[model samples]
Target: MPTSPAPLAPLDQLPIRGLTSGDLTACADLSEDRGWPREEHKWNLLLTAGMGYGIDDPAGKGLIAACVVTSYGPGLAAIGMVLVAERYARRGVGRRLMRHVLAEAGDTPLTLHATPNGKPLYEQLGFVETGRAEMVSGRFTPTEPAPGIPTRPATAEDLQAILRLDTEIFGLDRTPMITRLPAFADELRVAEEDGEITGFAAAWPNMDTHVIGPLIARDTATAQSLVASLAAATDRPLRTDIDVRHTSLLTWLKANGLDSIAFNAVMVRSLPGLPGDWTRRFAPLTVAAG
Candidate 1:
């Protein structure tokens, strides 16, 4: 007969501490073991951004059970990469970590991409749904050898151009992600025309999924082409967390036979001001300009 397993106890009593690359690696392994993407860049980015906390066992073995943290902004913050080990589920580790991280957020209302398992807990903490999105997956068809524009691996020289394009598309300066770009991802692609950079994409290798993001293009054609090229370059399916408002992108993804296997909430806590440009084009968000 199989041996009976030890019953899990409340993890609330566990101690938490700041993280380092060594401990961060172990924590990432725990995330991968639970079938989540093991993005070390995500961890380091959060640490560099603001704060990160990891829960430990009573014996001090440093078995990372839970983590909650965010990336910084002058006035805005993105609460991301919240993960907990499966063995410690429903044991209060999440609540404890959340209490600590949220407190660190101060009066700055935070935003995050929330998983289904996390919705209930976050809702109880005042997080609500903004909308639903699909993370599509598909293989890319080679770009048929076009001569309209030139593509090349992005370099430090192109950092200014990349930042400009990203800010134009995202309506925000994503300098933080760019600042640590070298350590965060394996590859970055830039599209150039007339000696000016117009588009870019970043791809990070992960244990569970290949995360690609912030695909900014001067036009839809470039966007589609960049997506195809990035997908072709990866060993795994490309993953992205997109807003529901991206209809054209969604339709193209779905047509390519990519599956929407999960959903997440775009939430904020006590948002004092709203984004005028975004809300004007996309409703259900209002008040003052952030």
Candidate 2:
């Protein structure tokens, strides 16, 4: 008689491992498996700038679950790109992955933009709702008379200023992610006043639309100017995740042309709230890397 097969290890004991550039395709495949867009471009950025974790399928079905943690120094980190295969839903795969991340993160403050379906699980894991972000998308329709704020394409000289402004408002140093914008984005524009950089935004390609993110400005007028300028340069319809607290800016985006797609819960763990000034922070670079 054939001997009984070895006992299957529990999902919790499946051995989670660190992901690298080599796992890009598999990560994209897992995204597709969950019916989410296979954003290989975004995956590349996260995998490079952040640490990725995943659990492999014992049956050879690619990654069972995966997530990325983008740390800004030791003070803050954003968790994103969490995905689990459709076949393994509700089997503790997601919870296992998250616990691993939390363990690895230790006491570092953590943040993430959680979808409606994801909020409950995250809440159970100790993350509290601090705010919300509305995802607006569409072909940007320019209004008569553009914003008065002066805007121009940013140059190499503007890098330091951008990083400085980003750090001040973002409440953490993002040298690693901000530095990649110059090469990664299709258009990097800055709002200027008397030759000093006042605001900046970058429009990067994500599938067919240009995603405007890291929208940093001195005020509402400057934020509108930066967005308008980025829209003017690109023919592709624009998309960006705007903080709901910025009512005027969100309303302007809607009236100008975009429609609300969905809202993401901005949840934080081990912190009272996200660091930095949310007033000047119009939109994040991407919810994934926030």
Candidate 3:
């Protein structure tokens, strides 16, 4: 016979503590139970670059809720990985974890890609919709290779240049998190001009589909080159979450074979400190890590 889960403790009495490496498995399990796409390596990257908190069951057997807040430079922070065990749902556990992370965010403006279910909670906490991001995926047919911009696989030597370009476009220094990407990415491609790195993109395996993202470039042509390179490298269906603000880019992506599968609101709690020039951000690293 299947066993019933133990009843949760009262919300007010649940103890919260800083999440550590020891909690990675439990946290991954929490996300898996909720049908989220995160794997252990992704959880490890988040934990390494940000701070997290969790609430344990009253009996101290395991976690019932958890959240993470990743800061980029001093101007922006992203809140993600919010999860609550089904047995503990509707008991204020989500709110408590969110509040804890918000306090940790301090004075920086915060952003999150909110699903319909999470939008209401975020709205109650002062978040307002700023924009929309759409997830697009499909079988990709490689376009004719881009010309004039030399392209090659990224190496350790290229990390510093890539970080600078990413910081300029992302409006914050995400070196800590970005530095860890190569280890998880199936391929990291860089675009160069006159031996100077101008842009880059990465493709990582996600379940059955491969995800390509953080595609930053100085212009549409360069962005297209990076995307095409990534698409050609993988035979599996490819997916990416792109900001809808770039109409031309969206149109081009559609013309290239990918189709929009899902959309989410980009919500912010304060004035967004985005760079004056964000045209280079063809796609975000991920809605969660934005």
Best by TM-score: 2
In model 1, what is the error at residue 33, expressed in angstroms?
4.6
What would the TM-scores of all predictions be? 0.78, 0.97, 0.89
lDDT of 2: 0.93
lDDT (10s digit) by residue, model 1, range 1-290:
99887665456656677876667777778778679766675665555654667777654455646554544354456666667777766777777888877887777666666778887888888776665545565543342422345567888899887777555554555576565665676777877888998777667665555566656666555656666676667667666654567677666666664557666666667674322233112111000011
Candidate 3: tens digits of C-alpha lDDT, residues 62-89: 7889887788866788888889988888
Provide the overall lDDT of each model, using Cα atoms, as 2-decimal numbers.
Answer: 0.61, 0.93, 0.82
Which of the two, 2 or 3, has more TM-score? 2
Off by over 4 Å in 2: 1-7
Task: Rank candidates by TM-score, best first.
Answer: 2, 3, 1
Q: Is candidate 2 or candidate 3 better by lDDT?
A: 2
Model 2 misses residue 281 by how many Å? 0.4
lDDT of 2 at 29: 97
